[model samples]
Target: MTHVLNRIILTAILALFAVQANAMWIQPDWYEVTQPGVGTNRYAYSGNDPINNFDPLGNDFSKAPGDYDFSEEGAAREEAEMQNRDLDGVTDGIIIDKSIGHLSSGPGRYRSTQKYLEAVASGKIGPQNSEISRKEALANIRDLGEQFEQRSLVCDASCEAMVPGPGQTSAIGASVAVVGGVAAGTNSIPTRGKFKGSTPGTSPASIAARQAFGNTRIPGNVRLPAPTAKAPLQTSNRVGTVVGRIGPIGAVVGGAIVGTQVIRRDSQVLQCMSSCYSTGFLDR
Candidate 1:
């Protein structure tokens, strides 16, 4: 009986050793062939510690529960920060360009007008027997008036205050824009059609109406009275004047509002960064 018991125990021990050796030599179900060093070792599993470590896919060991993947998180955060920096750079460039353009445009227009007038006065170009033909002269005069119209569109105080600088409130910018718009509007009404001594009644429609009425004669030697040169309700001159005055104000106000929103968004981003730093979510 004792000999039989010993043989049974010896067989069980040999089977246990065989199972352990087989498990040690067994290859993983999958291998990370693309990886560098350990990829060649098909039998290596979870850094050769199958007791404490596990790799179900056989490519990489799974992290313990509650472990944070700082590398991936950090990479994602870095990408986001880079994009934000790029956006900020673009925004700043646009703002600077806008500021410079606004500051230079009014003076540039004035200088152009001065040069044109000087040329006309010097007889280099004029309606008289000068360099240009009569048709060209008329076109040049019309272009000059159009230039004046363009000048009126932007030659206002709002152009200066529409873009607020750092630490400025949108309300202040909007208020300044509104005030400037009102001033421009008020100045434009009286000078609507008075481009270089031209009068409001000198519009083409008014002139045509006057001429038609003046030449019209009734039967039996009766003459029709010439009508006064009054502008129609929806004349181009009237509408242009109204729109030119109102458009700038609206533009300025809209710019102020948009600038305010951008500022708020930037501030929020800053606040988020600050909070993240305080909570140890970001490094200084």
Candidate 2:
């Protein structure tokens, strides 16, 4: 019994380490953001902490570079080897711009701000740069990150700095959820004893609910393949999106045709009546 208890304790410690390992990193290429701009420059998503944030369709307009066209051969070549795959330049720029803006805009704290600005003043670093330059660049970013944390400047109305937007928060939440789910499954009672062969008394919904909510992977809990259903589902979604747009257009065309036909029919009837009256048909 003592040996079994020791093993259990050891297993728990190991599992905890795994959870911490998985929880450290955030999603790389996305930002949870809200910024002020023209109506045309708005992002697709908006929210603050926890639940309401979303990713934009493309780059944020404020975070865009003046000459930042990615179509050039040189730009593509550079992008192929960036630290963050999709938003490398944007990420670096946000850090630099925010550091500058935040530091310059404040009324006091000139000393710390100047130190940070001097650290970042030597120009940005790229993957193609020398080892010494890369290290120095990393050191600069680290200093700025420390300052951001010290001042709690990560999120602002214009969240354009080295902050975790909704995207990163979601990633962190998902990671934690995954760890919790997996841990829950390991200690779940329903996943044990008679769950392996023939489920005698369990309803399908209850079993499915256990598997989904409890994150269990018990034996005989296999999912059937449905390859043919995917295309139809996608097509249905597209049709739904287009239906409203097509409705008004179809209405306009049908109305025009009906109006023209009615006008022509009325004109013909009027002409016949006039001719009949002229030919004395009514008196006959």
Candidate 3:
């Protein structure tokens, strides 16, 4: 009994070590992000006071040099005539140029905002030479997913990172059997016992003999062919890990494994990063 227990424990330990060995190293990339016109004058609007809250929707015409409310008829006619006189000096007096006004300036701001989004998508936010390579960014995010796993970042109430692995599948199967056996108490118990004999590259008689007696080979009589090499192990090394960078941007730790897959699999990554950034944890 002690020997069997020892073997089980040893197997469990080995399985654990194997799992850890395959784990991706996820760490946060603290490198600052860079984008054109970010925190610079190109993004700034000329003649717009940054210190004051200028409301274009407000009725105040104080900032609008050409617009004035004239209550008196004489004043209103004189202002209109003066404005027309100013237009007469232009080369094309009949053509009214609206772009010279401040109202058209808002579109430039809108364009700058679009450029910002484009920069983010292209991963070119900082100085021309300053940036993490796409490969390194991917590698880093995978590591973050592993870190999230270790930190117990639960997705919904049940799922963590979807670590698809042979061991986890085996564990889940064993769990199901254990639960079902306790619940049903059917003839499946015998079928459960037969599962151990289901190893590859074994004969039916040998399986039967193994099932009947603990050992397979009859010591002196029939010799069996040697087993082939162990199958290459599969692990959850590709599981995605996300880490935040810049203000809202995030990096992946093991990007090489799951980088291309994350956007397709989970659209919630952006939401996750947004939440993490709001709480000021993802940057860490």
Candidate 4:
């Protein structure tokens, strides 16, 4: 009995180590738009990368990179000149690139779906990992626009789910998707023809509505509206306008007018809501 127990403990330890070995988490540097004022702006990259020689800042900014090898001296000088150009320039927004990983050697331990599947079979990951991966894959596929073009959904404002009709619902839907998850702010994407601008702190039901259009089967006779432009929110409320302000009121009225005419007017609001939820899977 003692020997058997010893063997079991050894096996458990080995399993734990194996699981840890298979688990991988990484932080990548991403870009953001830094608008100084109305028209002047610059770019900033956050996160760590030995290639770029950046140190983690504890917070997102802490791990940011400052310098990059500029191919042209003129380009390099130009960027430097804009670093603090017109100190009071408005920071319009940041443009982020895809996450980049570090160099790895030796069989490239983490490679191929087959290896991931093996890890699952070996009890390295709970089924939840598989589910998450599947969902991510589906989302990526949707973003690529391939899944949308294949579907035959009607892109008309009169669609029962999109707009209220004789026997249909009137409430429209929308969604928000933060670029880098919760750490990132809520971001809106326009629905097929419903919305024309970005709505911060939006609702989840709206997000579902946008996804619904992506899956809706529209006929050829009906037309889908173009996606609306999204306006970035002022990060600090100290200097800004409220929904009740004259400017804000005008915007609201304008939005409603445009939204009413678009097919996916609610898409931005729904996506913004999903982006702001700040917890759990957006779909859930």
Candidate 5:
């Protein structure tokens, strides 16, 4: 019985040894291993181990040539894209040359559609960064002109809206747009017409203002508003002419004539227009 028990114990010990030898050993937490050289630790390339030259725990400790070359190539490519970035100044709308990574590399219309649109909206960007058509640049100016028109919409009086008043006080033309978006002041445009020298109903104060600023001329591209009906004036204030002082009885007749004709003629149709609009009677 003693011999049998000893034999079983010996077999159990041998089996345990065999199992231990066959079992697979686990890696000692890969990061725990010392690096091969003086650099960032190496782990499997993945999100957890990002590439960073200065990162103490950065991976790719070998400094592989492929990684270095790739970074350099990427930078060079971006620089090239920047150099070629711009809207196509040639508006022929033909792609004579092929584009490289959204670059306006050729003489085509608007290579980078987004950049061109931004340049068109804002005149600040130049051809180095973006290109826009001359029409598009002018359209930007026109957009500014529309903004001016919208601003003019806020003007309460006909004169303020660029409608000629009943007198020599020249009303400014509507929506003056200049090249480069640098526009002249509205006060520069005159309300004077052919009849202004004759039957103008200018107030003395207005005439003084005109005389004060008579030197400046209106800029081009500003469409002169057509003539509108003048507002009725009191007998004492009939267009700076003191009809009461001239002839009291004649003043009433003149006032009646003004109210019946000039004052009541085309207020709505020519609210912001004038009577001497030779191009057309419809002030629009």
Candidate 6:
């Protein structure tokens, strides 16, 4: 019975030592400095829920097992989708501004052109992933071409006034010259000589015109493969195009009406001034 008691005591001592060795081996040397309460327990792993959360690097808990995927293909597809969405957003804004906001169309076109150039440089306008179909890619290119055409038209009409060609005078410039000449009682107010031959390609308006011409022809230059399936026509895009076409007409009519009002107001002011002068009110 004494021998049996000795054996029992020896077994208990070995078990205690084994438990201590296991604890020492598994306990972490470092703690989470960011979380003081949790850092106090160096042995804590994944908020003490090892089965639900994993912390392989002894940092924060990772997403629940199988909850999130981290892969190159997935990331690429996501980026491509985001780019396509951005392009769509820009297209929508341009359509709305061109159709309903004609007064601010110049700025709208400028903004859209910048966005298009960015998208092109980033390779966002073309098919970036397998998720985008050929038809969708073609449509994106077509939209870009249309935007370029619109910008070209706007630049032709307005940018000339900003940076007129050599020897070419803008209507506003001509009107000012004529008025100044009349006031000074001289016909020697030099009219800008007629367009003198070729304009240098380095000029701002010339460069813009060249860029617009090149961009407008991009769709024709690209050789896209035939789409496997036919894409349905989008009615909203058709409607927007129609409205954009009509916007300029509306703008012209509105300008005429405003011009008439301005003329009448100017006539009234002149009559008042004449009466004031005749009554010697000007002398007072």
Which regions of candidate 6 are displaced past 4 Å?
Answer: 1-128, 164-284
Q: Find the 10 residues in a row with the least total lDDT in model 4.
A: 40-49
Q: Model 6, 99-123: lDDT tens per residue?
A: 1111122211322333333444455
| Error in Å for residue 221 of model 2 | 28
- What is candidate 1's local distance difference test score? 0.32
lDDT of 1 by residue, 53-145 (tens): 222222232122211123555335533432333211332222111111111111112222233334444554444423334454345546544
State the C-alpha lDDT per candidate: 0.32, 0.29, 0.27, 0.26, 0.29, 0.30
**Model 1 residue 181 distance off true place after TM-score fit, in angstroms:** 10
Which residue segments of model 3 deviate by more than 4 Å? 1-129, 149-280
- Best-performing candidate as measured by TM-score: 2
Model 3 misses residue 170 by how many Å? 35
Error of 1 at 263 (Å): 2.6
Model 5: residues with Cα > 4 Å off, grouped in runs: 1-131, 134-136, 139-247, 271-284
Residue 64 displacement in candidate 5 (angstroms): 61
Off by over 4 Å in 2: 1-63, 67-143, 151-284
- lDDT string for model 3 (1-284, tens) is 33433432332223222222232111111111232112212101111211011122222322233222233553455344433332223311222222221112221122222222333335654324223444443454455435443332332112213422233334434433333332232212233355321333242322332344343333454332222123223211111100000001111112222322332222232223223322322223
Clashing pairs for model 2 are 32-165, 32-166
Descending-lDDT candidate ranking: 1, 6, 2, 5, 3, 4
User: What are the models' TM-scores?
Assistant: 0.18, 0.19, 0.15, 0.14, 0.16, 0.16
lDDT of 4 by residue, 29-103 (tens): 221123111220011110111112111221232122222222355335534543332222222221211111111
Better of 1 and 5 by TM-score: 1
- Residue 214 C-alpha lDDT in model 3: 45
Pick out the ten consecutive residues of candidate 6 with the lowest summed lDDT. Answer: 99-108
Report the poorest 10 consecutive residues by lDDT, candidate 1: 99-108
